[model samples]
Target: MSLEVLLDTNTCIFILNHRPPQVAERFAEHPIGSIGVSSITAAELSFGMHKSGSEKNLERLKHFLTPLAVLPFDDEAARVYGRVRAELQARGTPIGPLDTLIGAHALALGATLVTNNTREFKRISGLALEDWL
Candidate 1:
């Protein structure tokens, strides 16, 4: 599947919880295989699962991930990360480390990042964004 949209952690959580409904509605508007999450996003979700220690939530996460591709943070993404981090640091508007990685992943893959945290993500120049919420 050629992923066109990379779901951020918060967007995934909103979908999982079915809040506001529009996020899931917009998600459904897209074709399958065109949407996915970065491995960094999966890690963030995993952290939440571990912290909550809820088997039900874990199972839900597993089920949520079953159909979507979890794109890995590869060498290309690392290269993008370096550039992104440097640019953000230079601008004196550095976001969180994980967010930088996530943005870099989306930038590397040329996928539009679907996120609720646009204020933070918008700091990365040339990174496409869509706030489903």
Candidate 2:
């Protein structure tokens, strides 16, 4: 299925934790296969699961990921990453490494990045962003 929105790590966490009701509400407004997350985001969630040392949370994450697409970080995304990273670094407004990857991934796929961290992702030109929180 083609992904229309690529959820960033923080957005996914918000959905998983069910903190702000609007995130889930907005997420529910989308068709199931139309939304997804980058593999980088999945890795970040998995890292949190391991760090928490909770099998229940790991299982919860697994269940939460069932209906969502997990797009890989392919060569095209890597190419975007190289260009975006260099541009941000040159401008002296570089974001975190993983955030760079996430933004580049969404740009490579031509998908809107659903993230609450707009201040950081906004540095990369041509990257579409939506804040769900």
Candidate 3:
């Protein structure tokens, strides 16, 4: 169950929209099953789809998610989240809750996080990160 990379919500959206060539190329480098998403990302995408109220977008999102593995925020991830959140808070640099969860999940799996929001994701120590965009 070795996961090579975890796609962030932003990356997923970019892939779906096909607006950025670099991101698409980066994503193409990885095998379909090797790429994954946090359950948090799935939820976030679903939220955005619901908010947009566009059936076409919903179908596109569904098709986009079909091939990628979705990682869960299990107990180990929760523990990591607690430590990460506390450390960030002590440092007075709290990030978004969803980002924290994504970071924690990536850390637990030892997978690199792929996101354009490196500014915020980099705040978590020991979490590998890459920005395709």
Candidate 4:
């Protein structure tokens, strides 16, 4: 499965908020259909929505996710995640589980990961990354 990009939760949040023109502009450069997100990101956004307890934010998140492809943590992604997690653990540099999952999803789909947290995502071997923020 070919994908142009996989947006991280932070990038999606930035797009939803429309703050920091630079970040927003970077997101805008890609066509909506070409942009993708991991199911993990969807869950993360949903969690934020639930925590906020704001119907308005929930609506905004729904609208934002409508056009983008939400990739699942399928078998391939799971395998990638296991390898990545093991490698990081072996190196004594472990990132968040969600971040590792997101990286695995991107790797499985051959999509460049757009994130602001390059410092963490960079630890995943063979995962292409870009800092849109």
Q: Cα RMSD (Å) between model 2 and the true structure?
A: 0.8
| lDDT tens digits by residue: candidate 1, 1-133 | 5789999999999999998799989988888899999999999999999899899999999999989999999999999999999999999999999999999999999999999999999999999999986
Tens digits of lDDT, candidate 3, 5-123: 99999999899988698898889899877899999999999999989999999999888888889878899999999999999999999999999999999999899999999999999
Model 3: which ten-residue window has the lowest total lDDT?
Answer: 1-10
TM-score per candidate, chains pooled: 0.98, 0.97, 0.96, 0.95
lDDT assessment of candidate 3? 0.92
In model 4, pairs of residues that clash are none
Q: Which lDDT values do the candidates have, in the order given?
A: 0.96, 0.95, 0.92, 0.90
How many steric overlaps are in each model, in order? 0, 0, 0, 0
> Judged by lDDT, which candidate is best?
1
Each prediction's RMSD to truth? 0.8, 0.8, 1.0, 1.3
Better of 2 and 3 by TM-score: 2
lDDT of 4 by residue, 2-86 (tens): 4699999998888888977788898777876788999999999999998999999999999989988988889999998889999
Whichever of 1 and 3 has more TM-score, that candidate is 1
What is candidate 1's local distance difference test score?
Answer: 0.96
TM-score of 3: 0.96
Q: What TM-score should be assigned to candidate 1?
A: 0.98
lDDT of 2: 0.95
Candidate 2 lDDT tens digits, 84-131: 999999999999999999999999999999999999999999999999
